[model samples]
Target: MAVALQTLVAEAERYLASAKIHDYCPNGLQVEGRAQVRRIVSGVTASQALLDAAVEADADLILVHHGYFWKGENPCITGMKRRRLSTLLSHDISLLAFHLPLDVHPEVGNNVQLARLLDITVEGPLDPTDARVVGLLGSLPEPLSPRDFARRVHEALGREPLLVEGEQMIRRVGWCTGGGQGYIDQAIAAGVDLFISGEASEQTFHSARENGISFIAAGHHATERYGVQALGDYLARRFAVEHLFIDCPNPV
Candidate 1:
């Protein structure tokens, strides 16, 4: 029922191929806790609430898609950061975070999970030239109107997406989960009828309207909830350890 912390991290890195991808934050074990892990709590982000939930669950490790120490974030361990790290260290709960690797993994990636939930047949990468393409180009079984496509997204994600309608029905689509509105341009270049991402920017509307491609801003937290859970389930089955997915919903 228990596995060494090093062993768990090794298994995760091997499963995700984390070393092959370059990411803003370090992947694998970000913080050390107990040497052995029996229970794991997974979530979208490593927020204070999630840490508290993990502590309450008596989790030995916390696995997440979003972790601390980003590319541009302050390095100081103070205030919120200090408190979060303090809680983890105090409870001896290890933190294992995988960002870009989790997003692009073929089996359990966030985009793939979203595609499965939305019934999309993936065709290729949104940006074929990019070495690490996080977005996908795909198609529906049949074309749906912009309105109907938005409805499908709402039903699948359990959250109504902010829709920027285009003139044509959507057959081919491109998508990336979690703050991927920036990839709309790549999707447009790929000549997709619709593009979906977790968050929208001010210019996303204009880009959609100008380019004649529909856009959907599904909730970031909702879109990214799957990959971590998938990873957790995989770990549970592989290592014979208990896994819990704690939902600390973020509207943004």
Candidate 2:
């Protein structure tokens, strides 16, 4: 089934409430392609591999969590950027990216989906006072040792997370997906026994150790893989269009 490109974009923007949130990159349609979209390919990032996969799949649109044109990035269309845009334009495939909005959505957001996968009971936002906070505070169904928690993360995400052990048993936890190690401070302040994020920084170790909070650096790509797929599935069900999630794995 084919849906108008404008209609799809509008529906996405509305569903995600894109305009209400400020983000580093523009949300909704980043590149205009065919007027009607029949098949879509979604992924965590719109890298060359994902675009190639979309092209191979004969996708009319590409939906992604990470898209181009970020704030403060070099605006020049040269080398990698040039090649990527060239491929999209040549194939006439639309690109739609949603960043923070995708991460914070209640139902299909990265943090929520990750929690659901891990059987966490969400308590509240990591920063309860901040409406825009992306990280969340929650608790496991049952407390588990640091090793067991790490093993569970590996089992669920198919990747071993870098573990910083704290307590013997972790109950209350906090998490945010995709380069959210900075939020460790907030989690610490919130008194969470463990904090999970996509990437780890040099200072993350010190913060985790000094604050006595367990830290887990799950792969950024692995942690964020769920949101785009969830959004794609929702769109597919809602619009009666085909959606494919292409996995172009990245360790970082």
Candidate 3:
């Protein structure tokens, strides 16, 4: 049986502790839809294709990693923003978003999910105090060569990872899913031997070499797909809602 939209929102808000976010956008129910939600759709971004799919599936709610109303975006709902929101509102489809919350939740978070896939046991938050600490610190069950570790990441993500070996057998590893090369220094301070994140800056190579930590730049989209997918599956099972994870390829 389908659950009320409010019930799903309450569950997700409680699970993610929505108040903890210092987010650029509002974190929940960006657009209200039917009160009784029988079908839900999820995606990384609330793109046009995702909305089209949700509409075709007759979804009552859309959940996503990125939704509209970013901090600095123009307040007027016009152009692309207008179209996205208009479609959902017109179709009576609710939109629910979990951003940093989804990224930081210990069990279903992006970093933790990646760690689980790589056979790494999490130690703790990469930045313990930061609410936006999407990075995680962990260790391999046994130390693996840089090459071997890189292979593991590739196989797990099904995409070739960019590796910068820094003269260390990778046992303690640090990871932040999605464009988190900025956290390399944090990983270094935490005594990690290898740091992995989706996407890297040019300076990352120099920083990794100098800091004595091997680095891996996995694709942003690939690394982030897991957490949201897991969340979608959980919702489907819990509410018996028809949940579909819309995939939109992004190389960066």
lDDT of each: 0.94, 0.94, 0.87
- Candidate 2, residues 117-219, lDDT tens digits: the string is 9899988899988776699999988889988999999999999999999965899999999999999989989989999999999999999999888999998
Q: Give RMSD (Å) of candidate 2 vs. truth.
A: 0.8
In model 3, how large is the Cα lDDT of residue 159?
92
lDDT pick, better of 2 and 3: 2
| lDDT (Cα, tens digit) per residue for candidate 1, span 1-252 | 899999989999999999999899999999999999999999999999999999999999999999989999989999999999999999999999999999998999999999999999998799989966599999999989999989988898788899999989999999999989998889999999999999999999999999988999998999999999999999999999999999997888
Error of 3 at 6 (Å): 1.2
Instruction: Give the per-residue lDDT of model 3 (tens digit) for 104-207.
Output: 88877778888899999999888887756678888999999999999988898789999998787989988998888999998989899999998999999999
Ranking by TM-score: 2, 1, 3
Among all windows of ten consecutive residues in candidate 1, which has the lowest summed lDDT? 124-133
Pairs that clash in candidate 1 = none
Write down the TM-score for model 2. Answer: 0.98
- Kindly give the number of clashing pairs for every candidate: 0, 0, 0
State residue 235's C-alpha deviation in candidate 1, in Å.
0.8
Overall local distance difference test of candidate 3: 0.87
